[model samples]
Target: MNMLHLPRIGITPDINDLPVPETEYVVRQNYADAISKAGGLPFLLPYHEPVGDYLDVIDGLLVTGGLFDIDPALYRQTSRKDYAMKPARTNFERALIEGALSRAIPVVGICNGMQLLAVCLGGELVQDISTEIDGALEHKPDQSASIAHHRIEISGTSRHLQTSAGEVHEVNSVHHQSVLPSDAYQVLAVSPDGVVEALEKKDGGFAVGVQWHPEYGVADIDTIIFETFLSKAREYSQKK
Candidate 1:
């Protein structure tokens, strides 16, 4: 593909606390590799106040998973347990998501990123599925990211069905918090235990969020998801 044809994908990095005074902004290597493999230019976005500045340059927004939780207060819920959170990162991501959606930019969120997206769209999170839902399967499995932990049944009405070869897809789960999408969003997939696994915008625009790390390329569906997002992004870039 021509360099100009490759859509610019702005990816949010994980904020990590270093022993020193400065904080580190980093993304997993596979996240960038996946975007590149999908024929999109991956750009790590730093935490900044002006979301428009970033939105103005990127054709797509990729919200990556992190080792923290979003402030439950953002979803009109109180914290049930103490957990680490980067308020600055959360604030920046919230603004970036809102700006991207307002401008109709393609977005794909993973794990905690998905949770934040749900919150941004007036949805809520399960907080901790194990505690909140009775008999919920273990969402955070103790295994490699490349291994499948569970299978999700894709909804027949979901846009995901277009790329999926079958209604059931084996996915690697790594999130304790799952999305409870708002009325504006449609639940695209769910686990056998009844936990939501994926969601997309009701209007059918590419604003998909998955509670698994698709960048790990755990399954064929993972690549399809990235391809679908990049395809939409390429379209958005061409119009620009």
Candidate 2:
């Protein structure tokens, strides 16, 4: 795909609902760099009350990792450990993800973004990894991915996984919560510990969610993920 022919990319942004004179709601440059490199216009959307209004303004969506967690109540349980559950953000994230999926929009969800996708699809999450999985990969939210964690086996036939070959990727880890298996979604990849690493909607759609942060890697989202997404967005754009 030509860089000039890329479609607009919708990058979901974090919002602040509190009454404050100053707030920092920004999208990092890495996300844009990846999208631009892959040929896509960058569009960042905040937690607007009526999120649907902006659904048609972009060709694809990337749910970036953030400081908040999905409200456990989304899965029919009260908050455990009182995790930094952002109810409003969680609601918006799910709505946007579902909105995009309904239209067959090429979508990619990072750490928290993947969690949002899971809960939105009626799946549960292990809120605290330290408590559940001993010796779990370290997920430092504020720290940089300066170290290689572990390799993930990419299941064949998965576009996202096949992008990197049969080789296990030496990617960074920086998340505690993980997606629990769901009947509606297939586990595309997993950590050596048997944790759900990535998933795809078996119902049919260009969607995938991985627990790792692709944005922080050497080449964000890899060429295949971005190429596939860009190609889909291009096809969708030309049809319109």
Candidate 3:
């Protein structure tokens, strides 16, 4: 692809739930700005239409972060009252993710987006990290961008380690639920407390999910994550 032919990257939006008279579909500017800076045409994909339709147009899919959690029922677990969820958003996102994966399009999931990736792939979740895991570090960090909440050891054998350029790197943490150990996806990296911090498909598609929000520009490795995804997306677009 040429410089003028940037891939159209479809970004999933977060449903704003402020209990007002109106509902809004919001995509964080940072997400779009990052994709644009990385050489991809960022488009905000609303939840109004079937995701399959959008799959035929966009070259890549980016699942964004949200304040709500995913319903456990999607993974065959009983729903929890304490857990807050946006069924409409999850339903739409699940469709988009499944469609994108089936088409072999590059997909990147961040924060809750990562959890949705795990659940949609026949895997389970930690649900609540602090209460479920022993000695779990402070996965939830404040709004400060400079804070390095935790460190994740990139698995030497995992493809995602190539983005890190090293064995271990510090990241800004801002999530509670995480992927439980599973075979559906290869655990690419993990927090010191054993929480799954990063993952990629076991069968080797251009699908990757990170527990941290790379759009916020926290660590140096964040650039690699977006650059790699956009590069893969560009190649996919050229093949088409």
Candidate 4:
């Protein structure tokens, strides 16, 4: 593919302290692999001061899934549960997303990324789905990553997902926090249990967030989402 044809995608990495005394910035290979497979150039981005520097060079942003929860304080809530969160990473992503939005570049947030995006847009989240929503389906599946644990109904009016509202589709689940409906974005899809599974910006600028990990690319809908996002990125790059 010509260099000009492929949009540059900036992907966020998770910070981890696995080995004693050593902090590592890591990102799952699937994110980059999937972006490359979808015809975009993937670049891993780490948390740093002034994220706008990174955003200035990329055509799009991909906020990947992480194991920690964003501090509830950001969305103006308190939680009793003690879950790990990286304040630095959260801060950096917020800046990055803001920069992307200012440029009107396409941005996709997966899993925790979705929560970040929602919270960034004045939305709250159910910190713990099991204890919050009654009769909610199992969201943190113990099964293999390749398996779909639940179904989501996409909205017909959603330009990002491009699926009917009444149409149900199966998807892999791997998160405990979910988005709460807010005026910042239109609820694009939801699980039968009422968990927000997908959201799109109301003004329609190709900004979307999904509760599932579409980087896994396990379903046809995943391909559609990424392709549409990349198309938007391509348009932005051309305009630049």
The lDDT of each candidate is: 0.86, 0.74, 0.84, 0.87
Clashes in model 3: which pairs? none
lDDT of 2 at 183: 85
- Candidate 3, TM-score vs. the true structure? 0.93
98-198: candidate 3 lDDT, tens digit per residue: 98888899999998999899887888988888888999888886656457777888763556335542477778988878898788888888888999988
The lDDT of model 3 is 0.84
Order of quality (TM-score): 4, 1, 3, 2
Root mean square deviation (Cα) for candidate 2: 2.8
lDDT of 2 at 86: 66
| Pick by lDDT: 1 or 3, better one | 1
Candidate 1, residue 100: CA error in Å? 0.3
Q: Candidate 1's C-alpha lDDT?
A: 0.86
Q: Please count the clashing residue pairs in each candidate, in the order shown.
A: 0, 3, 0, 1
Candidate 1 ranges with C-alpha deviation above 4 Å: 1-4, 19-21, 160-166
User: Considering only N, C-alpha and C atoms within 3 Å, which residue pairs clash in candidate 2?
Assistant: 9-41, 139-174, 139-175
Task: Tell me the tens digit of each residue's lDDT in model 4 across 1-240.
Answer: 344678999999998867746888899898998899888999989778788788788989999888899999989999768989988898899888877887788999999999998887789999999999999999998986688888998863786556776877789999988999888899988999999999987774789998998888777789988888888888888887
Best by the TM-score measure: 4
Give the alpha carbon lDDT tens digit for every residue of 1-240 in model 1. 454778999999977788546878888899999999999999999888688999998999999999899998999999998988889889999999989999999999899888888888889989889898899999998898899989988763666436543478888988888887569588888888888888887664578888988999987779888998999999888878
TM-score of structure candidate 4: 0.95
In the order shown, what is each candidate's alpha-carbon RMSD?
Answer: 2.0, 2.8, 2.1, 1.9
